[model samples]
Target: MKFNYLVFFALCGFLNLSAQEYYFPKANADWEQKSPKTFKIKDAPLQEAVAFAEANEYSGSRDLRIAIVKGFEREPFHQILGRTKKRGGPAGMIIKNGYIVAQWGDTKRVDMTFSVTKSFLSTMAGLAEDEGKIADTKDLVIDYIWDGTFDGAHNSKITWEHLLQQNSAWSGELWGGKDWADRPPSDGDIDDWKLAQPKEPGTVMEYNDVRVNVLAYSLTHVWRKPMPLVLKEKVMDKIGASTTWRWFGYDNAWTEIDGLQMKSVTGGGHSGAGMFISAEDMARFGLLFLNNGKWKNEQLISEKWIKKATTPSTPNANYGYMWWLNQKGDRHWEGLSENIYYAAGFGGNFIVIDKEHDLVVVTRWLEPSKVGEFMTKVNAAF
Candidate 1:
């Protein structure tokens, strides 16, 4: 009787493992796809959700310049003098077990993915830590970036953890903008812009682009190479991502790195230069996280790093290390898993991953406010 039970249990385990097997496509325009029915996903509701995403227009101004002028957008200080364009229409893919279950629009067209680049930056930081370049996440930033960036009493107290949690509030001018000017309070004054009484690091969770760029510049100091190149060679190529994707910095972000001039990349396209990537490529990135940073036999990113990256910040439970946590009450839709986290960008770009369901969903040019509704419809089908 014991032998029979053991055999039955082994068979069940094998079946479960077989179901989790994934198919990663080769690097090219040709990639295989699967229907929703293949995974027992209800076809009609999924179709309805896609149709909804297709029809609904983005809530922000079509011309991003208008959005910026009207205070509806929080882009970099340089966007006014930089390149800006009307965003493309809705495009996305829903992947189940690494197979494309549903896709719409031109998945290959590379488009600007605003703050989604933050998550990519977060990944780069993880890679730095894994490579032993940055020994500890809790260490003082001034230890590596010895420049006067974190010199003051309050700034000197800042650590990598504080920056990751958006609580650093590190004060300084970066790329020509004061720390407070990036996303200043509506009633901010000159004193506010100067950060005369900057909040103590780790006690405030302010989403300031200048401070984020400070983190980016610090990463440049640690890697001693252009961030885009490091990311391309280490992460993108490993996952078979297309070469068309580009990560950019501002026009004037060049700096001398060991006698070679290198541009310090931004974490997001706040001032018009961030990660411009295809939906398919972004889907591949999301799949990496969905698989806990593994790609087939190779571990592209450490599972430990991914866990810390997704862990909620103490000050902001709905926010992780640049990745947005799905811990919000509105994020709880039927069939949604507990550990879902996502990379969200401006203009309604989102790369949501459900590790529990082994799913990845990428959306571009979607209505920002309707994301919850759209995902809820998709979850209802599950």
Candidate 2:
């Protein structure tokens, strides 16, 4: 009777192991695909979502350098300070229950992801938190780096959480970029913005690339190595992301850490350099998040970190740790779940994660205004 009980338990374990649901695409191999019908998804709505993305291509010129200047024409000294690439046409893939249900255009073409890089940057911080590198999110920046970066009275109160939530209001210049010059208030003149009183740390949310770069700079100092290398060795390589992907920094963005000169990557392509990656890889990243940071059997990032990263900040209900939330705020999608959160970038690049449906959608070069509607259409099929 004891032998029979043991045999029954072993059989149950085998059955549970065989019941794994998610599918992770192998590196350099053909990704497995499935039909929408397999999951009872409405094919017409799914196809319409793809067509809507393709038809609503970003109005910006394929020449991103020109687009960069034209889009941020208001900001003073906004030049292509780093490498910018001519982008490919509309491209995307829809992952439902871990298999590709639909794909459009060139999925493998490497293109600039612009501010979508912030999500990855946030992941670095999450990894740090998981590893105890960042002792606490509330810890003051000056505690980690005694440099004059956090010397000012207002800047002294800035914390890691504030930086991650885009509310740090970090005041200073780094890599030839001034804190106030980035995406300044439209109603103010250059001198007015420069002289404007900085907001209290954690009091307001501002989307400033200069401050984002400061976070990158701090993370670089914390890791004691290049952020890109840390990303590749720790996350990307483990997730089987393609070799075609690259993270870049401004030409002048370099620092000496431990007597070794390491380049600190930017969190966005506002000044031109950031993550240049394919749509498939972006989907893979979204899948990792959908699985709560677990890549297959290994947890690349902790679930605790993900919860903290996705929770809405007091300043911005629609924003998290560099990730945009669909929490019925100004940026919320009309019909989509409030739980949906995504990484958005300039020129309509996105990595949308819908964990409720086990769905991951990556789209590039779609019109920025059409994103909420596109998501609405995509979710309709499910």
* TM-score of every candidate: 0.91, 0.95
lDDT of 2 by residue, 182-220 (tens): 887778578988898999889899999999999999999
75-138: candidate 1 lDDT, tens digit per residue: 3353442345566778999998999888888899888888999999988889999989999899
Pairs that collide in candidate 2 are none
Q: What is the lDDT of residue 295 in candidate 2?
A: 87
Stretches of candidate 1 exceeding 4 Å from the true structure:
1-20, 65-85, 187-196, 328-335
RMSD of 2: 3.1
Superposition error at 2 for model 1 (Å): 12
Residue pairs that clash (backbone atoms under 3 angstroms), model 1 = 76-270
The C-alpha lDDT values of all candidates are: 0.81, 0.91
Model 2 gets an lDDT of 0.91
